[model samples]
Target: MINRTKLCSTVVAVSALLAATTNLDAQKAFNSSDHYLAQPLIKNIYTADPSAHVFKGKIYIYPSHDVEAGVKENDNGDHFDMRDYHILSMSSIPGKVTDHGVALSVKDISWAGRQLWAPDAAYKNGTYYLYFPVKDKQDVFKIGVATSKSPTGPFKAQPKPIEGSFSIDPAVFTDTDGNSYMYFGGIWGGQLQRWSNGKYDENGSKTDLGKADEPALTAKVAKMSKNMLEFDGPVRDVQIVDKEGKPLLTKDHNRRFFEGGWMHKYKGKYYFSYSTGDTHLLAYAIGDNPFGPFTYEGIFMNPVEGWTTHHSIVEFKGKWYIFYHDTQLSGKTHLRNIKVAELKHNADGTISMVETYKK
Candidate 1:
């Protein structure tokens, strides 16, 4: 009963409408430049465990490089070696990073010898201090300190290792009272170490602030002696047990939910972040004090659909944004790409993970 001409017109109109709707959806998905905003902060260089510190308004990213591969040669060809720390700096831009040249190189340090991994840079007074771990020919690892007047530096390593302990992943935190502390540990009995005056105790122990269900330890604000390396108060033992009171250490393997420990204080509370699992997914806990009776805060970000995630957190910049690494494009090479995304905290303080880029 419908006219042939009218039926044909109706079919054409519906097709045109569908085409217009598809075009509009595509425009909404692809119009924003945010999808194209990612630029390599560091180049073809495979870097990992990136930590950023803002000094004099410039951001310095100190990462462990595959320096060994850069220097070694095999029968077929030369392989990239990860034997040194590579420091890169950039000016502050909301969504961009400008590659400042190599701020520090291990080959330039006299005592490094070989195998410098996971360097952390921090500025105090008029000097920039880089805390990094290095291994000798025997493969024994130790943490050391290097000082420079500038962040991008020809850094000079201390004549010897700090306290002669086999440690790596050194992170330095300075309290409001001018006291400095260093936290470093991995599978090999990870423990927090403190420094005061000019002398450091290799046997400096950590305080065991139990989990949230337990009583919190009294927060201490101690002063450093003239030596700048020794602590004045009793160092407490840090508990590495989970909520069920079980040890976090894995007997068969080394690393047990313990690597890349970072602490930040915000609004009078301190947050401790670390990496866990064989895949190194980012996990965190919160405490009222730096030496914490911390409670698990849950996973900030897990491995994506196509990539593995690790060593990351949200930085407060007007709003909170998470920074992490992804390996979707680069295979198992550890040549990971850094990503940033806004983080939304729930009423109960839980965080929601969102896509790093707009697309």
Candidate 2:
């Protein structure tokens, strides 16, 4: 039996803690004892693009299942030939983590083409929704959804992809008002650059290379409809701007949206974080609302060991943490592993720059 009252109280405490944060930027780095950063969470199987969430009292991780597929590595992300998803859960951090085995796979998806990229999950009305981005038979990437009664799911697919969904890395964030919005998009092999013209193009637009004058590409976000199966409105671009209120240009590698979009609320502000792929850094922007004209804040995690810098931020048991991936498992980019560490938020709303744990 679960203690609903205790869970509710703990969740409230966590929000209060974040809401009450102050300019504690000088706070020392988290001592090693507080996190499981010394090694990957699961050793038997390779995993990446971890989307960690708190369901009830336990922490549930919805991660893309990385496999040692011999597909050649290329700019188009052909090497990351993942075919399924494995849901993981833990009673508490730095504690026993359980791999719930195969929750969803390519074979089970009739419309799926190949390479199940990053995925995220959400729970509503006693059902768990698994949102994933994958290619179809035409080799065009589109987002899809699956459902299960239990958090560790053997989810049943919806048969067709979400009509207006595209790109990779589907992150669903339910706001305080209970409205759920999804943030998604990525570049390179993820095929976001191909959609620069607002429509899917196999050859990509002529501006795909991104001239110095053009604004850096943007990520896509849309609100979940009442059915939770489709977008509530036309997908919109998540504007990443500068302090002066100008969009970052395409040539700005240091601060731009490359891939891996995640949204989290802290002190009533929305933080939109992503990977700066070419630079291998995880940066973020802040805005007043879910669909934002977010101003670029700064990088949170420095360049990681892996070629990719994908992550998720979550508040678990009164503390905040980052769930990210690295290529340390096999020293190969495609064969990556998931890791976690304490993420500090200053009272001034600035995030402390985090260096990847070397141990």
Candidate 3:
């Protein structure tokens, strides 16, 4: 027969050993040494349209997952068909990218069908709101918001899209004075769609090939209300002009606005940057305020292998980085991966040209 006291002691020791092992596994969930070292910040899966935010001292990157075209039975070929987003993060400590997992997927968003494109996130009163664009049941592109308590979240999607906001690439900028602004628009010609005799006009008001005189391909910016759910004021145009106040994209000038409008304030000046559509080069214009008569500064980044170049800029630990995407990974245009590089600004406040990482 066994001693009862000895047996009880043995059982307690085994239980303590098992508990300790479980805690060790939890702490080792992320492999810090295996973190991505160079440009394509993530390697396991494809990510695109990186909207980065500096939250609570860590850099949280919200990017669209590039799902291959033939994933479904009815999948179209060589087209953008993204349906979800994942929140990726890193801290001041090097080589530690935490995969926060799927923050918001199309399945979680009721109104969204397919095409979950570029997204942006903002924090207010302890709640983090994610703003994304999706194709509604009516097949029109609309922007909606999702909220969560954590920066990397299983965010709850709102019931409807933001009223009066249409088009793609929804970016929110919070000013220094606590005032928030939202910038969005796309399809260069669509932005230049004019008002003809009170009706919608499509390039009918063009002079000098709709470039020199008329501000074609201009993005829109508006003030957001306290809740950020609705626009607080009328949307205004972000006019694009050259340093000499001439049209940035004239018949003689090939440079023009395509899509992917992102805004950031550095040294009290607002930098409105975007990707030149079809051409794929990333460029920018600077203004004194969010509502801009921005002067085109020139190309900000060399074009990536992909047809699109959606990006976001953030200052983390006194270092500025530009987060964008490229087609180097999957070797296909639609299947792109997010990348980051040191973003330098000239002494005069203009952005320095960013060289793409080949590897």
Candidate 4:
């Protein structure tokens, strides 16, 4: 016969042991600061295309989560194959990166393929909108938006991708007048595709690839609707030209907008920032207006020891930062990790160069 008192005691002891173990696991999961002890803001995972924003009082970063292919059929080390995104945040305290779990994943997006790329977040009207790019079944990359009531979210993506967008690297800029604009594109001439005839088609004409050193098409910018679900107007090519209306270029044959396009408004000036291709240096141009005849400034950061550098600039608590990624942690060209460094703007409105952090 079982003794009731002894059985009750044994049950209580087992319950206590299980609770303790669960608590320890929770602590370990939330201990993200421990992983970010190195210069890279995150560790143990590959992160790329860091798009940062100052929401409420903390700095939130939206970066594409890079996972190396483990399945024998899925191995393609040369190509990018990010499948999800993780939101990382830190308060005023430095060196603390709290992983906000999976904000959105390819599985959540019905129209999207597995190539989940760069993403940016914006808060408006009590809702947070995450603008991201994903490949569709047609093998074309399309930009889409997701929403969440909280900055950190298991975001719900819209049923359809943004109608007029057919490129990658979607960055949104909200002006003081409450108007918003989206800038996005990628390599292979950096042209914006249009949505016509029930499909995304090329814009205007293609660039001459033979003239690689000459300035080709820049990023395409369009006014977004108030809800940010659709485009308000035609997507136009960004004007990167000199006073003579000639397309400008760097000496080494790089387009103004190769992959990443981040816009920042400061002191009534719109800074169009992007990554110059091949060389992989962060550069920018200054424009009086968002869709501007921007004057090329120069490189903001020298090339890191990586093949790519996609980033975003944000100001948190009066200090500015440039969030970017490199291949330091993975020790490979494709698997990158997010990193950040302090940025300074000169009195003339030009930004100072950001050096890679080493600790």
| Cα lDDT listed for each candidate | 0.51, 0.84, 0.73, 0.75
- What is the full ranking by lDDT, best candidate first? 2, 4, 3, 1
Q: Report the Cα RMSD per candidate.
A: 15.9, 12.5, 19.5, 17.5
Q: Model 3, 95-175: lDDT tens per residue?
A: 577788888988888887777888999998889999998877755567899999999998999998987776678899999
Residues 118-206, model 1: lDDT tens digits: 66776777877877877644344567777888787767777776653444566666666566656565432222222322233445433
TM-score of model 4 vs. true structure: 0.81
Steric collisions counted per model:
32, 3, 0, 1
Q: Per-residue lDDT of 276-353 in model 2, one digit per residue for the tens?
A: 776677999999999999999998987555578899999998999999987655767788889888899998999998
Residue 318 shift from truth in candidate 4, angstroms: 1.0
Give the top-scoring candidate (TM-score): 2
lDDT measured at residue 227 in model 1 versus the true structure, 0 to 100: 38
Summarize candidate 4's per-residue lDDT along 62-179 as a digit string, tens digits: 9988887653321122267788888999886365799988889899999987678889888889999999888887657888999999898989999999987877789999988999
Backbone clashes (count) for model 2:
3
lDDT of 1: 0.51
Error of 3 at 271 (Å): 0.6
Candidate 2 is scored at a TM of: 0.88
Residue 186 of model 4 has an lDDT of: 76
Ranked by TM-score from best down, the candidates are 2, 4, 3, 1
TM-scores for every predicted model? 0.66, 0.88, 0.80, 0.81
Candidate 1 TM-score versus the reference: 0.66
